[model samples]
Target: MSILLSVILPVFLVIGIGFLAAKRNAISPAGIDGIMRFSQGFAIPVLLFQAIANLDLREFDLRLVGTFYTGSFTCFLIGMLAAVYLFKREWEDAVAIGFIALFSNSLLLGLPITERAFGADATQANFAIIAVHSPFCYAVGITAMEIAKAHGHPPHTIPAKVLRAIFSNSLILGITAGLIVNLTGLPIPTVVDEGLSMLVRAALPSALFGLGGVIARYRIEGDLPTILFTLSLSLLLHPTLAWGLGTAMRLPDEAFRSVVVTAAMAPGANAYLFAAMYGRATRVAASCVLLGTALSILTAAAWLALLS
Candidate 1:
């Protein structure tokens, strides 16, 4: 109960503050660029480096990694395909919806949340998620962007053009750096670790606040039916799929719940930006992300306690 309250309450309070502030017209998305750089370049890289550097890979479950990522990959593909079938919009928009529904902010909010939710013993599983987050985003996510471009404006130089589409992505870069250091058997000195910690401390608030700021500027356009239809897949479908798979794999209830419930979390790993940059329904994606993120705090925390 204490763990649930401790984890859920702070996040709720932040959202509450954000809701109030948005009502007051104080929020703006202009500072978003700066927040993006800070979180992507410095804060995220440091957090990943520290997490990866501290990890003793031998302590991790090899099968768990395979299971989790396999589940993630499957979920991602299915979401994409489902969006294609369901959306009356273009296929490119469908692709964007798919990625956002399946992927998450594994490095940013994921690491800290998993640590707080599951403690040190679960850290390695959390790291496994972090490790996959960037690579998956780059590989699958960039491909989705290309689909968008092919559907819209075509850039010069095939590969370079494709690379440019995803080049500005910092989360992908940061996770890659962390993986390199982790794989290289490098030792991070105490001073470097301390610096890393300081940077990581800002990741959650900046991102959540940035999201809140972005949402404050507009009202949702759809009626209840449209909103529920779009969001239900993210809130219900992916998590249920993950949960079914996790249980079949014999993951303990808590672990099963963690991975499954978090899958339903806001499509965190840069999907909204991808949608906006790619000229899909930008407002729709943004709206989905905001609502999904706010809803996830309750959904996830409840799942954690229930499973525990």
Candidate 2:
């Protein structure tokens, strides 16, 4: 109960406020888009930049990374296969559905929830997971998507397409720059660091609010089975696999919490974006993002309790 009240509710409250504001026309769709652009394109990237720039690379554990990503990939494959075989979706739609299961809301939902549930100091593992998140997911998703779309075209072009998609993201640019700074020990001026800190303060809250507005725009369409399947993979199976892997590897307590909590997050808006990008499974992707996020409130609280 405390976890629900203290950790989860506050995060959802901000999202709910945004949802209401948008639904009530208190915030225009253009205004909501502007907020999302500011948070996702600018503030969140700065937050990630500062976090990675100063992060102690030693805290990165191969076991932890392997555990989280293994679960993610497993969910992706399962989602894709089920979409193709069970639901009879197109190859392109299957790939998009697979991506919906692949990506989690690690930034907006994962970071804040872990920080509130654990402590500020325990988020390094989260940062480590996030550092490669967009790049890794985009690489896999774009590659699969390109391959599905190939239909006997030359395979060589797929690599370039994947690379272009990965590198073109602003988040990836921020992460790549952070890696350069970290590896090279480049110094950020004190003023710039302070400016980033200010942006960091606004990152999660604004993103959560914008997320709510975005969710408000998604009407829960048909394809109930596909949406439920996505929710199951994202909210249930992914985190379960993470928890089992973390335990098998005997991850440290902090790393265990980080991996499981992050895995348990709902499908991010990126899932819908990926579908929209390919113009496949857009309805299913949007419904999953909406319903999965709503369902994750209870599911996340349950995971936290079990972790405790």
Candidate 3:
């Protein structure tokens, strides 16, 4: 109970505040966009870099990494297949739904929340998840979008586009730089480290507020049943798979707990954006983001209580 109040409550309260602010127009959409942009471009990257730079590389576990990735990718495939077969959707639309089904808001929600719920050590495990998350999800989800849009031709430009996106990504850049520094045993300057440490302090709340703003702005706009289905896959199925795989892989308790919390995060903001970009099944994407976030307050709390 104390854990729930101290960790989970603060998380949802900030999100609730943001939701109210956005819903009431206390913060304009453009303002929300700016906040989100800063979080992704600067704050989060700095935070990730700081985490990775200071990481004890001895704790890096490839088996845990493999377990989480396998569960996540398996969820992606399952979601894709369900959308195509059960929903009777076009392949392109199904691809977007598939992305919504499995892509968790691991950064904005998972990191801070996990840190609070589980402790500082948990963030180390989370760093592993964040490092691999975008690349894998984007690769699978974006490839599906391209392949479906191409209709059997498969766009020639995809590889370059993906590479460019990955390399140019701020989060990935931070991770790469940190990994390089950590591997080379280069000392981070005190001033530089302090600056990043300061910047990272703003990452959590800004991210939650930005996420709430996104949720408030994107109204649910799809078939109710389909939207609910997507939510189920995200909030329920994904985490369950992660837990089972984590157990089978014999992840240390802390790592397993971190992985489960990350897996339980709501559908990501980018999932909705990608769906919009492809101009297929945008409603389903939006609905999942909105409702999944709202429901995660309870679901995340449940997971935390049970895990604790």
Best by TM-score: 2
Per-model C-alpha lDDT, please?
0.63, 0.94, 0.84
lDDT of candidate 2 over 249-299, digit per residue (tens): 999999999999999999999999999999999999999999998998999
Root-mean-square deviation of candidate 3? 1.6
At residue 238, candidate 3 shows an lDDT of 82
**Each prediction's Cα RMSD?**
3.5, 0.7, 1.6
Better of 2 and 3 by lDDT: 2
What's the lDDT for candidate 2?
A: 0.94
Compared with the true structure, what per-residue lDDT tens digits does model 3 show for residues 1-308?
68768987798888888889999999999999999999888998888888888888898999778877777777777777888899898898888888887689888888888988867766888888888887788878877777777756647888876677668778889888888888999998899888888899998889888888878877776488778887888888888888898988999998898889998989988889879877988988988888898898889988888787
Q: How should the candidates be ordered by TM-score, best one leading? A: 2, 3, 1
Q: Please, what are the lDDT tens digits per residue for candidate 1 over residues 67-110?
A: 55665666566656666665465677766766666566554445
Model 3 Cα shift for residue 62 (angstroms): 1.4
Q: Identify the runs in model 3 with alpha carbons over 4 angstroms from their true place.
A: 1-3, 152-156
Q: Report model 2's TM-score to 2 decimal places.
A: 0.99
Candidate 2 ranges with C-alpha deviation above 4 Å: none
